[model samples]
Target: MASEKTNGEQEMPKKKKNRNEELKLHDLLNDVVSPILFPEPTNSAPLLHRIKTSLSRNAPLIPQASRNTARDTLLWTRAGSPLRPLLLISVGTITILALTGLLVFTLLFLFATINVVIVSLLISLAAAAGCLAIFFACVTVIYIAALLVAIFAISTVIFWTIVAITITTAWIGFFYTVWLVTRKSLGFAKQSLSVTSSAISTYSAAWGTRNLKHD
Candidate 1:
């Protein structure tokens, strides 16, 4: 019985020591890791300062003349005058055409590069092996003929001719096309608004008749 009491006494202190240690660990975690993950007010002030500093570091350094030009451009675009729409349409059309031309040229160059490599390989094979010379020569001629046909097909189209035409013709056609489309769109919009107004008037008249009968 005495030995059993002594063992129980020893276990009680150990339990107390373990509870104290756990409490200290919890306090330490709350002080260190908790502040990092969900920062305290004191830490948040420094974080905001750091963010401001980073944004300042990355901000652009625009020159005064460039800034004034950008401001003027924005103002002109927003003034809602005839010149504004004309300027916007012209810029957008030119940008689209330039991008399209660039894409076409890029694809053409890629294909041309591949064709050159294949032709060179064939030519090398023909030179090295006597049996392939006639085959390579015929292939070369066919390739040249195909390129000519492609160029002829492209240049023959009216739309394609616009690319080679003088700037005056291109710009005039661009404005004419835009004007036609705009007029069509405005006519459609007017018709839609008239139809909507008619429908609403009919609805209101029907509702008034029903309400009068009930009264």
Candidate 2:
């Protein structure tokens, strides 16, 4: 009991750390993706003031070094931008795909579980009959029947394995098709963000150099 208590105490910090990390990731993803899928509206003010306001709210998710890059992304994705429609489409696509995948997985798992139970029952019955045949070695029909049932059980396993592979391939093809449909918009958004990140990095470097020369 003491050892168990010590182990529990040791594990508490690790669990807390994991929870904190998850929360941080959740916040970061929310900041990045929410700007696109669900744009936030800042009060009507000067551009710089609005940017500052938005940055204040979302800056904690990023490090100081990347704050400017995050700000640039925020500007591009803020409400009233033309990218909203693309955002809508991508978000909708992802939502549908995730739900459908969950549904497919659930049904497949259920089917496999049922198949396993049925197979187990058949195998058990075959084993019992085989044991009886051992007692009555003269019973040829019982032996043949047991062999056929064993064969059928093995065939069922192979058939389900094939079905599972075929289903997985079909889902992969479907996901690939959906990705192809949204490829352009997704590519465009990522490229735009990359450009903005580069621009911010260049600007920061130049400003730092100028400050150093002055000092």
Please tell me which predicted candidate would have the highest TM-score against the true structure: 1
Worst ten in a row by lDDT for model 1: 57-66
Candidate 1, pairs of clashing residues? none
Worst 10 residues of 2 by lDDT: 132-141
Give the distance in Å from residue 54's predicted Cα in candidate 2 to where it truly belongs: 37
Question: Model 2: residues >4 Å from true position, as ranges?
Answer: 1-79, 130-215
Local distance difference test scores for all models: 0.65, 0.61
RMSD of 1: 23.7
Best by lDDT: 1
* TM-score of each model, paired residue for residue: 0.36, 0.26
